[model samples]
Target: MDVKYQVFISSTYNDLKEERQEVIKVVLQMGHIPVSMEFFSAADEDQWSLIKGLLDECDYYVVIIGGIYGSIEEKSGKSYTQLEYEYAVEKGIPVIGILNRDVNRLSAEKRERKKVNQEKLAGFSELVKRKMCQFWSTPSDLASNVATSLHKLMNKNPRLGWTRVLPKEHPIEEIVQTVNVDIPKPKNVVSNGILTERDIRKVLKKGLFDFGSFIDIYFIIEGLYSHSNTETKLPNSQLEWIRKNEIPAHLQQVKEIWTRSYRCIYTFINIRDLAQKRGVPQDVISIGNIFISYIYYVLTEVWGDVPYFNNKPELEMAPKGSSNVKEIRTLSLANLQSVLHDSTLSTQHVDLAVGVAVRWELQAKNYSKAKEYIDKLINRDRYKLAPVHEIFSTDVESIGYFDTDQEGSQFHNPVFRVLCKKGRFVHYLRYTEVLLMATEIYFHLSDHQKALYYINLVRIRNNQPQLKETGNNFIATLLDDWKANLGMEGSYFSALKRNGYAEKVLGIPAFKSVLPIPAQEIALNPNMQQNEGY
Candidate 1:
């Protein structure tokens, strides 16, 4: 049987220091624990008790009788080293005693300085010699000799030694404590609103561009290979900041994003409040509620958590566990459309509202709810797949502007036509995309029949043939549709993350599914912690 013996190394402190170290090295290499004077305290009563305790626990004793008689314990009238050796003898510990081969040949400084000390040294050497004494001229030789002797002693004595997994007096929890990381959430359920001129203009403005561009650049790096081949090498520090998914300090002229977003949300609420106080139109309150909801959606996507309750912006962050993006998106749409019924909300705005709702529901993984929003636009039959020419078309209409058939601008689609004047249909959503999303949802739901039906609906719209069902065909079709329609406008990367494909697509680890909080933000806010990987 194997055992790990604790072998006590006894020696004069000054002369045998090197030899003790060498013995410890050899003992450790042989899988035994070495105890020695190096770890002991003074020659007092308490230390004597400690030494006796150590001797009692040890499996064997080592007496290295060098040239010098070390300091004496006054009570015992013997060098402490000799006292320890004798105590081990009384305790019946297996002893391996080593002697200097040429003690007389050593220099005067290496030998005992006083006559009494010299006599004590000679007596101690004689006592150790009474056992099976070993002789060595050097530390190395003594280490090797004592190792062989200790092994024999251990086999002869046959006592149990130290081991792992021994029973303890207390549980493991007594010694160690664990701390958990804080995760953030989204908050504030304002009676949410639909798309409006004020909301659109605010989204389009410069103050919000930093926040929007933060998203664009982030997805650009994370989705680089999805569209471009430009290799990006950034310093770890800058990369860490980018990983926070916030605007980098160097990219901004001012850190006004938080204030701007806050002000925008607050201003809407204030306007709505003042209007109510003045007995203004009910549509005014609807506008405030819907914008508040939109702001909540934006903040949730950007910061992972934000607070807005009962149409109010709470300054603090929301708890991550409490967030339910699906419920928020679902409830907000109802309030938005209800407000619309009381006002003349345009078809384009209504489509945008539902498109946003579809997006949020998908993000929340509420497939059925997302499909509800998708079907609304699909039932309307107003949006369709952009023709091949329309998709590949230039941003500007052809020089012959009179040609109604000419290629058009990149912003005319029902979902994405907000910025386009008259050029063509550039959509954030189209009938084909809605069909693809339905296909994706059903595939996730394991309804292969419906998945196939919806996928073919998209295929026919794109003037392409229906896909043949096979392993991973749904994913292939979804990617194909993304390539043909939503080509590289920041949605592909998000979709990849949602489907657990970002690691395969972007070569990033799964723990980095979200960007780290900005390093500066973390530095400034002690309450915030970086996301796991970053």
Candidate 2:
């Protein structure tokens, strides 16, 4: 039998209205039907019954504890929210609690009530010996923790029963231990006495120079180079030989670098500074810088050109591609956009910047702005650039040029029509697609006029006739038409997400629509925060 799980939100209405809303938003984002008291009138007994039934039917329960507990008498003494939580626990449902850290600083009466609630919760935890509940300090934290917990719960087979149920004591540690089993070490370990060809082969076979292990290898090399023990030191001649020609020539030399140099073990910041002071070229530092920058561009959506090392200035620079640096002295949003619009600029360079800008705007939720840039690419007559698909999707291998009959298929004799005939220029993102995105954003923001305008613009560009309007219902009609025509082009997901229409159409929350922040960012910046419901 196959069944979808429901999540019921239990919270004190008086104290946690905002938090409850947040949780509901998260639930909706997660594609689950959220059951809460706000959906009903204050005095509706039928609503109360429905809520209880929802609680009973729900596969997971989220109990939000705020500053004050609602009076059972006011409807008051203990809250219906607390009672629902108790009921959920009694029914053996998976329950998680979100408690604000500020609860400790409440008024005396409220504090006393909070204490009682805390005692009751503690007693329940002790009695049940279940690690089902967790606390979060902030709304964002609550959302993230809930998402993570729910994801773990969902991935495990329910048939596994209580084994998958997390216990409260050292919960994170337990989760980690479960996920990563200890690998026993080999009894016969090799000492670092001699650099055997076999040892070199083993290390090289592991592809140990990738970004992940580069730092570890660098540190190991550094330890070998900077040995302080005179008894175990190599001669100056050997040290000089290693310094000049230690790293294998076959290793991929540094291609590009970013601003982050501290992470590179071979690139010592202080040593580089000293070298600069002595007016000497630091080849190792330069290589490390270029490699890191290339990695940064590949991993993150950073706007502007791929940074290059400027030998004269001795700094990483984003020089305008194939243009005189003196003429394009400064870089700004307008400058970048103008460069993208210019027909003279290399299409590859323009498209590179455009792609980065598109991603940046999408992340910042500036869909209209993103579309404007995209429009320039698709409507190349207005700007001198070629149509987006002509430039970006021109790769013969990508569209399978040789896979079909030469006379029957468009892919058979495909030719590059955008920017230049030479294979150097390619369009990364197109204008029509951006317009589609803008339309979706406008629809989501409930600005029907803008949505219709952008959608009709695309239709006109595609040689489609203007859609006929039937009074106020015209917008909905046009929306349906757009979906029918452009739905298969990857616009459906964005439209549903931006409009908050996913809950009704796909039975999922909008929170699930967003991508999570890179885990590395979280590790680096403790103050940096994750998105809600992610």
- Best-fitting candidate, scored by TM-score: 1
Local distance difference test values of all predictions, in order = 0.56, 0.42
- Over 1-534, each residue of candidate 2 has an lDDT whose tens digit, in order, gives 222346677766655666677776776566444556563433334334545555665678777766555544245344555667777778878777666556667555445355686775444334333555566676678777777777676666242111111112222222222211221122211234342333222222122123323322222222222221122333322232222222211111110122222223222222233334445433323332333332333223211122222232322222222222222122223334544555544454455456445544554467677666555444544333224245333442121111112212111112111101223322122344456555655654567777777777766655677654335555355445545443322234444433445445544454434323322222222333444543
Report the lDDT tens digits of candidate 1 across residue range 412-528.
Answer: 233122112223322233455566677777777787888888777767766888776836556865875665555434456556656767577556566555543433233333344
How many backbone clashes can be found in candidate 2? 26
Candidate whose lDDT is highest? 1
Cα lDDT, model 1, residue 333: 67
* CA deviation > 4 Å runs, candidate 1: 1-303, 306-344, 391-427, 430-432, 446-450, 460-463
Report the alpha-carbon TM-score of model 1 versus the true structure.
0.45
Off by over 4 Å in 2: 1-335, 338-344, 347-379, 382-428, 434-466, 470-492, 500-504, 516-530
